[model samples]
Target: MILLRLTWLSLLNRKATLLLILASISISVFLLLAVDMVRHQVKDSFSSTVSGTDLVVGARSGQINLLLYSVFRIGNATNNISWQSYQEISKHPKVDWSIPLSLGDSHKGYRVLGTSQTYFTHYRYGKKQNLDFAKGKPFAGLFDVVLGAEVAKALNYKLGDSIVIAHGMGNAALVEHGDKPFVVSGILKPTGTPVDRTLHVSLEAIEAIHVDWKAGTKIPGLNISAEQALGMDLKPKQITAFMLGLKSRLSVFHLQRSINNYRSEPLQAILPGLALQELWQMFSLAEKALMFVSALVALSSFIGLLALMLTSLNERRREMAILRSVGARPMHILLLLVIESSLLTCLSVLFGVALLYLSLGTLSPWIQSEWGFRLIVQPLTLWQWQLLGILMLAGSCVGVIPGIRAYKQSLIDGMAIRL
Candidate 1:
């Protein structure tokens, strides 16, 4: 108890230097915890991007490539599957539901998706959560469109507003289907997935807009008015991919095998969950790199604490001599320094935790609105608790070096000081 009191008094006497050290340690702790939290949350978000779907079927391509273009809207498909293949496979007895996706169009940098009402009814994300409307209902007409939350907010669109889609994926598309403008019929709530950046339209609408185009350009001397195109056959001939939900979980592998062996055209079927795991594996190196960098920042802060104590040791020779005259032993001085380090570490951790929660609370809504993922605020996870324990142990160990030096100096100074 006496040693602890002496340690406290000594820290108070050097409060300015101690506070600076405390701030540095606290900020380091914040960075480490924040990085860890984001890493885990991002993985969870990615895994939950599409659920309740057993298989994603597309033309033969790399598993990761198909998954990226189909689920994440990250890239273009290598080839498109025939609409006839989709019908034959989706009718399989083992398949419960399927959602067709037709890509290759964009509206102001956001990808446009051509799908059916089945998409609105069967699509899910984040724990089997269904898509819900923020304003209006699903598209009921050929020229109607539904906007994702981010697309609506970013473009300032509302129900009944007209928007033209470009022929390709680029923002500055040279060829646009301006004649067949789509009216916004619905706006979906924030879903915290790639779905938030997409524009949904009926498959027929996709076919109608391209009726007058050939080979990625307008056909010479051909002009199909929107009303005239609506009267013509608009059945889609090909689609980028389709998602399937099985009637029975046991039938997933059977259906996957059958799709892969289809006799008509080359095709590939992938389990969404397994594909996601493979995708995460590709990114594991970057995640580890980030964690290592944050850890180094924390270690550097502890080194700063060590330097502070060692530099202050020479100036405290007179104080040590006074302690010796008051019957304080060398062991007591060593223990005092260690206790001071432990206290600083604990205080800094507490401050860091407080700051982390405050930042999450303030920024979570904006993050969800802008980036399409929620930052859930919860108690420290078990891994975080273990990390704190390791930090405390490390801090105490750091103090040992300066403590030994102080112990030896106290012995040399003895009970009297010449100064």
Candidate 2:
């Protein structure tokens, strides 16, 4: 108890230096924990982007590419599947429900998705959570549209507001369907997924808007009015992709094989779970790189702490002499240094956790709006607890070097004072 009191008094005497060390370690700890927590949450969010679906069927392409374009809205599909193929596969004995996706359109930088009302009834995210509307109901008419929360907020759209669709898939669109405007029927609650940045419309609407468009441009002098287009055959001939839920989990592989080997146009069916695992594996390298950089930052902070204590040792020579005069031994000085180092590191852990909570609370909503990532503020996980223990142990090891030097200097100074 006396040694602890002495150590506390010594740190108080150098409060400025102590605070500097505390700040350094605290910042390092914060970065390490933040990186770890964000990495885990991002992986969770990615996996949760589309749940309750067994397979994603699309034109022949890489699994990751299909997953990214279909579920994440990250890239354009290289090819599209024929509506005939979609119908045949969707009617399979093992298929329970299917949701068709029509792409290749945009509304003010947000991807416009062409799907059926079954999307709202069957689509799931973040567990089996169904889509919920913040205002109004799903699209009931051919020209009605449903807006994602982010899309609605960005465009300042409300129910009954009219919005035009662009022919292409970005903000810099050249040809827009200005002649046929769609009314916003509903706005969805935020899902923290690609769905949150999409605009939903009926597949017939997609075909209707493009009735007079060909080769990525409006057909010269070939104008089709919205009323005429709607009355025409509006059935979609091709779709970018489709998601399927199987009646039997055991038949997923069999259905995947059948779809892949179909004699018609080349197609691929991927198990969502398998594709998600592969995606995570692809991201593991980046996550490891971030963790490595954070570990280096922590190492540098501990090195600074060691140097600070070692440099201050020379100035405290007289203090060591006074301690020895009061019957303190060399081992006592060593233990005191270790205890001080442990206390500083423990306090840094606490401060870092507090900082993380404040940062997450402040940024969660903004992040969800901009990036569609929900940063959950929760208690540490088992792995994070292990990491804390490792950090504490590592800090103690860092103290050993300065502790030995302090012990040696104490012995030398005590003998000189005795003489």
Best by lDDT: 1
- Model 1: ten consecutive residues of lowest lDDT: 410-419
Residue-level lDDT of model 2, residues 16-37, one tens digit each, is 9889889989998899999999
- lDDT per residue as tens, model 1, 1-419: 88878888999999999999999999899988999998898888888889999999999999999998999898899999999999999999998999999999999988999999999999999899999999999999999999998999988999999999998997673578899999999999988888989999999999999998887788999999998997898999999999999989998898899999999999999998899889888889998998899899999999999999899888888888888888889987788889989889999999988888998899987887656677889888999999989899999998899889989888777876544
TM-score of 1: 0.93
lDDT of each: 0.91, 0.90
RMSD, one per candidate, in order: 2.2, 1.9
CA shift at 216, candidate 2, in angstroms? 1.5
Cα miss at 166, model 1 (Å)? 1.8
Give lDDT: candidate 2, residue 278: 96
Per-prediction TM-score: 0.93, 0.95
